[model samples]
Target chain A: MKLTVTIAGVELKNPIMTASGTFGSGRDFEPYTDLNKIGCVVVKGVASREWAGNPPPRIVETYGGMINAIGLQNPGIDVFCKEDIPFLRQFDTKIGVNISGKTIDEYVEVAERLASEDVDLLELNISCPNVKEGGVAFGVDPFMAALVTGAVKKVARQPLIVKLSPNVTDITTIAKAVEDGGADAVSLINTLIGSRIDIHKQKFILSTRQGGLSGPAIKPVAIRMVYEVANAVNLPVIGMGGIMSGEDAVEFMMAGANAIAVGTANLLDPAATMNILAELETFMRNKQIEDVNDIVGVVNKAAISP
Target chain B: MNQSINRSRTVCKIISNRPLVDQVFEIILACPEIVKKVRPGQFINLYCRHSGRLLPRPISVCEVDLRNGHLHLIYAILGKGTEEFSGYKAGETMEIMGPFGNGFNLDSSDGNYLIIGGGVGTPPMVELCKQLKGKKTIVAGFRDNPYLVDRLKQYGDVYITTDNGSAGFKGHVVEFIEQRGLKGTIYACGPAPMLQGIQAYAKKHGLQAYLSLEERMGCGFGACVGCVTKVVADTDTGWRYKKVCKDGPVFDAGEVLFP
Candidate 1:
């Protein structure tokens, strides 16, 4: 009957957390779902200074997914500490702030600013493709990823969780690199780079011409990457990408994710995280499973006979 | 600037869905709760059950019939989302959220008001026309066939135009307004070009105006920040991104940047 799992020393009542950028500090979704029920609330990416983001037409829908180039638009860290932290403190859930910047210094400054803040965890965003600067640069290479992870870990008062990019050739190398760099935990598969073109206009749908693809279409790729990273690294893994239901969370857990995040599904429905958590609890009861942790990486625990 | 407290998504029964013009259709949902709360210019996000389409379609409230508790919506087929909506029939259900977005700022109800709509943008003006307390005139422009004129006529003096000269006038909405020498506090919604023309014209004539805008959106709530529009900001860049879903599908015409 227990659903508790700790992510990097932070004790969460359950393993359910809203993916950063999709939950927006829980202000807009306050009416849609109960924040108290969730285990953790991960706010969107914030930088040391405000980012204007890309021009209009930032998102476009494809077959089973959507692509976005929001460019990590935010009101900056000062605004987050003053506004978001106080609002989230009113909730019963643990707070995880997603931090991003165009340079290593900018990223470190943001983490340092939140060093004395009330956040429970800090998720470093190094995979945003819409921006022209440091995010993709630091994430695509293992050495750069480790460097940023180490730099932020030095200043961050809260436990640091490095969010990884799926655009690289090998995700495991980056996972292990961060582990060696002193990262408390690692969250993976932050959107695959993709694009959509308008046949009639003969132009790209996104203003940036390319964006991160998310939703159900990218689930298979996310699952494969989560499985690989979970096996390669000893650090606890937070798996995400195209998770829409309780079954989706279970699938990620089976693939070695200590916890799973609800991202694109929140865009589909504001209350999706709650519905998913409810379904996950229902799944546990139905299966007669006593501990939720018993199911983590269950697929890898029992390999198929080759 | 925030949503009405404790808003929940509702699966309303589809009362009716039928084509109004070649590609445009009118749908009615049997939800009394939404009927009681919606204001002109507020929108609802319609969720598609199709697995491929994750983002909900935010459509403006065309009409709110409180007596019958029926909410009317008008949409034109543009892509797979609308194409799928076009096929929705009665006896079925739809998942919808909101009455979101700060509704139109209704002020000086007795003042002169001009409501303009271009193509698909005209639908939201119907409810605006009904609620305005001032002397109101509606100017709606269409590409070809003009639908919703009948409903619009019930609330105000309705002016119509079509590109093919199939309706009341043969010119565009702005051209018709200029030709007729009409000036007032204007409210509008339309394509980028049409909205830009209105914003320019309003500024030249020293008139205050409000406009409804559309953008490609992810989470039709504030969270995604994917559907942003350029707005006048006090920052060094002189502008910043505002969520079209949460901040607006409506903004002061002067503050919105056409570029």
Candidate 2:
């Protein structure tokens, strides 16, 4: 019953982690569940400077999920290091800091700042669709993706995990590009670029008109992309999109992800990460699985063998 | 009272869920944890047990019966999430997390409390009015037919206005405020237009006002940063985003920038 999983030399007690933006450095959800029960807490995206984010009406409910154009609102590295880092350090779980910026220099600066911090890993965010600038740019293009990955890798003291944007022509190319750029691992998919309209008002639902779609609706696409990236790159893959339950996390692992991050589900249930972990363990016990790692990429083997 | 109340997720049994007016419903839940912590202007994020409705619907605390350990939530059938709530019946249960956001600061001033609420925003004011001492005047504006006037009457002198003039005062609530010349520290909530009108009215009279705002929210807690409103700042560029779910669902009337 070994549930522990290793990603880029870091060992997590379990495979369940909170997705960036959904869990704000583990402070918000502390009331509902114990932070020590989670394997890792992937906090919201942090930039070199404080981000004011976007205007109001930043989120809207769709059919199976929701859309958000938060524009990566954060308190910047200085405040995050001062406040969020110390708060998260009280927990037993590993810490994965998600970095966002409008340029390579901003990314490198934040990475360098966190270089001496007590974080366990650095998640390079090049695929945030809500921001107008650097987020989707580096992620959508292979060359730029590699360039940013290489730039951050130089200063990032923690093992770098490049998060890929789902709004791309070929995700594998970008995944390969980061691997070549010396990334320790990769996480996909950030979010799909989508929009919704208010028929009654005859206007876009989100103030930004377009937003990144997440939740159960994007789970299928995320699983597909994770499968593709895991096959294309040698790096370990952390899969996330719309993981709602323990079954969903297991599905992602079987599809070729070493671990899974719970995103929009945390919004619905604050204790989602711990609940999903229990569900994952229940899933293991029922299936007579000794090690959770035994299920990783198992679907691919079945698909190829037969 | 605990300064920092820990938010919890619990299954609250429904004591009653029935229509109050057209597309408006009143639900009473028996949850002591929520009833104990909830203050006026605080909200609860309600989860619809029905599958496919993944996001929680944020509803303000309309009333708290501490003796019975029951909490009252009044909401309109605005969309699918609420429509599902409309279908829930007594003996049923639903998941909820709360009492979130900074509740109204009850200690601001000693002036007569002018509690103005429009449509669904009227509910939270009921609780606020009940707890306040001294003179309390409640002015409520509805789209057409008014609901909850009787409950509001118990707390103070209740004034009513309807869009179609089918009720107490003819025309908009702001028009009623303009004509009546009511004097007090204004505590208001409603659509942006109504709040903007109140903000203007407060400025003209040199009165302090507090407004409760509504926005599309993700996590009812502060995590997602999806529910933000622009507020006046002192810097050269004069505005910054504050979480409506955390920094406020209630804000100083003069500080909010209504667009």
Candidate 3:
């Protein structure tokens, strides 16, 4: 069966990609999961300059998922090129860099810095909720979302995929806004705002108080958002949020996502991506499906009023 | 790709899960591959049967039964994940991915060792104590009567300290060290306060020391820059977060900034 899927003019060998921030520039999962097997390795969010990230207690386990306020801690673009890029280039899979910045200029600067670098695509991470500024700001509003996308698109050397936050009221508006701003593709939903209180301690578990929630718990919300966005925009949609198994992946594709990403599942099992790919293939064979892309948006429905 | 990494997921069967003391249990898994590769202080992320609690709990290697191809993991019933783990039956299988993180460096020189572990951290010291070559003295701290001290006693002279004075000395490990005038190249893994006290004592005594740190982790491997600890940095930021999961669960007592 043909598993190949296209996103933003780039033809991925398979529709399976590691969600940015979940996979650490391909180093963390390099041991168990081969980089060549998956469609792409979307590295963690990197800024133009190094970020220290938040203080301790950045993660807490919830019912079906975990919350993280990692604050996009990275060694910056220079380190990414020197350390991660060479390592990833050795693999046959496509590389997608997730860029994080505190301002529109910072976003543009990150895009410009990677402009000449050899990479497959750029994912503008304007939806990270842990930071004080930049990430959640540009993503929550349609104006700011479009503005950041337009600015990054102008300078990005590779096709741009704008990752959207699910914390907003209207995810479709922001998806359409990024599409208007020249985003080659749109990926959603980037974790719902979630919090956990330690009843014993009677305090919040995470230092940030609220963190991005991703896991099987948020899968249904992601599907709904993916379905709506696919119908609302002409841009290709990359669906992600708590995808754990091959069956869950097929469900996302059927909900109108051209490709799907594996996020929190990677943490639970670094081999999750490879396992997911095999499971997806197995699913296709069992269903007598000839091509993987043939199942995209199969759960056809008209866009609900937004 | 570099040729060194061979990490993969394996479903290992449990051989035993019995409580050694109040709320503390020792689980033995018949995992030959992991036992063969596990160093003294290395850890494994153990998964439970619950679908709601997704992330696997990180448990240290308590002992290595190389002859039987068994791995011992001791854990306290602290949180829901571990509590769920406490109920696992012997015949049931658990999925795990590790032998991850850097284990303690049993530096071969001089080798007069002072192994210190506190509370739940004490279990890892059992494996560590077994591996040390030269003079070994182990000090473990707990809230009450110690459970693993017997296992530790098999390898070295074991000292115990309790917060309630119900067992051994009525104090923390550092206080016990002060009373005994303990001096050696120190190796320790414990809570932040105990580790900080050890760092200070080691610095004041001018002794070489190694520390294993514990932090809230996101992914037990290197992804998700969660589980970061402050470390001394020379850059403008002065101190930066190094992944406790990757850079350490073990660090030089001197290099870590407990502040």
Best by lDDT: 2
DockQ of each: 0.57, 0.53, 0.60
Model 1 segments beyond 4 Å from truth? A304-306, B1-7
Local error of candidate 1 at residue A203 (angstroms): 1.0
lDDT of 1 by residue, A1-306 (tens): 998999999999999988888888899888878899898999999999888888878888888888988888888988889999999999999999999988889989999999888889999998888889988889999999999999999999999999999999999999999899889999988988999899999998888999999888999999999999999988889999898889899999999999889998887777788888888988999999999999999987589643
Worst-scoring 10-residue span by lDDT in model 2 chain A: A266-275
Tell me the tens digit of each residue's lDDT in model 2 across B1-259.
Answer: 0111122567889999999988999999999977999999999999876677777899999999999999999999998889989999999887887899898989966759899999999999989988888799899999998998999999889999998989999888899999999979889989999999999999999989999999989988988899999899754468888899999999998899987
Task: Tell me the number of clashing residue pairs for each predicted model.
Answer: 0, 0, 1
- Please, what are the lDDT tens digits per residue for candidate 3 over residues A1-306? 898999988999999999998988887777778889999899999899999999979999888998999888999999899999999999999999999999999999989999989999999999999999999899999999999999999998899999999998899999999999999999998989999999999999998899989889999999999999998999999999988889999999999999999999888778788888888998999999999888998877433432
Question: Model 1 — interface RMS deviation?
Answer: 5.0
By DockQ rank, best first, the candidates go 3, 1, 2
* Candidate 3, position A300, lDDT: 79
DockQ score of candidate 1?
A: 0.57
Ranking by lDDT: 2, 3, 1
lDDT of 2 by residue, A185-263 (tens): 9999897888999999999989899999999999999999999999999999999999988899999999999999999
TM-score of each candidate structure, all chains considered together: 0.97, 0.97, 0.96
Q: After superposition, how far is residue B83 of candidate 3 from its true place, in Å?
A: 1.6
